[model samples]
Target: MMGRTIFIDPGRCIGCQACVSACRECDSHRGKSMIHLDYPDEGRSVASLPTVCMHCEDPVAPCAEVCPADAILVTPDGVVQQADTTRCIGCANCVNACPFGVPKIDLQAKLQMKCNLCYDRTAYGLAPMCATVCPTGALFYGTVEELRAERPGVQVADSFTFGTTTVSTGVAMVVPADKVQWPVPGGLPVVEINGKDVR
Candidate 1:
């Protein structure tokens, strides 16, 4: 069965950390927040990048491949799950192998922690806690058809390249419809500000 997926638009994030707080309230996580809210650039704090587990589809999953105990598994519906603590030996292999840096080993619990897309809730046709409490519409949970209709000008891409390997992710990103031209000039005009021209 195809399940509802989560989508993120970093531009819409205000760094309020409501998603992070909500993630902690997930019953499956045991008071741990799986989501990581970060500033992509320390100097440029205009936007926040919320890091999530991008359940890779193609190339299978790197975390699953490197697991010696078969701890990490991707569900049929494409949710890359947190490690099975019973089988997991706290080897930290999954922490190093994931391209998106999604998994982290809990030193105290000796287990891995990461986002499972709120499987406990999504399995019941309910949205994840993070998506449900987002103050700004930055985080969302919906069908692909609904996303396409909601964001007509953005392309949803799930694939990315890390080193020589191409990883396919289940979560899609909203990219501009037109190919991006980088190194574009800043939006500041050349004018005398305090007797100095701002470049």
Candidate 2:
């Protein structure tokens, strides 16, 4: 059973960086989390993926399998967290194994860390702080099946309204369009107008 996969709709990220603060709000994700922003885009309202540990379906746990210390452990909810402290030699092997680059070595703490996904909040049926703090209602949370079910035929997005306008004026844009195509990359919605994939 997949607990809840954290969904990142880049069209919703305004580059506000508020989620960074949200990660630090509680002890769950407070200490040197693996979650991080990457390679800032030059375009206004540039889209960025908050990359972190995307727990895989494979049997060989990538990070844990690579770790000599056996530092990574997969939780019941599918969140992989640090498991072994005594065995950790801080070789940074697991850090490199993560494809999303979700593991970080806390130089201060001298251990690897990443986002715990606010285990405490999710236990009570509350949204994670980052999703809650998202001003644009973009960083949403829910079961994958539920989220996929919620928008089956919902028109995804309208082409004329959000399609060209936001891209035209230049984007200090709040709530960036998913993309110009009805489905850009993440299988989300975007509108294609004229020559541009105006999102």
| TM-score to true structure, per model | 0.84, 0.66
lDDT of 2 by residue, 1-199 (tens): 2545455556656667677677778565453434576544455547776654445434334678888766677766665665466666777887786544567776555677666666678767887777778776456566545545763422122112222321111001122334435422321244554447966
TM-score between model 1 and native = 0.84
Off by over 4 Å in 1: 1-3, 180-199
RMSD of 1: 7.4
C-alpha RMSD by candidate, in order: 7.4, 10.3
Location of the lowest summed lDDT over 10 successive residues in candidate 2: 165-174
TM-score leader: 1
User: Quick one: best lDDT, which candidate?
Assistant: 1
lDDT by residue (tens digit), candidate 1, 1-199: 1346877777788889999999999988968899989885667566797877878777677888899999987877778788997988888998997877888888777898889989999888898888899887678788767777876655555666554455667776555656322211212343556558766
- Which pairs of residues clash in candidate 1, taking residues 3 or more apart in a chain or in different chains? none
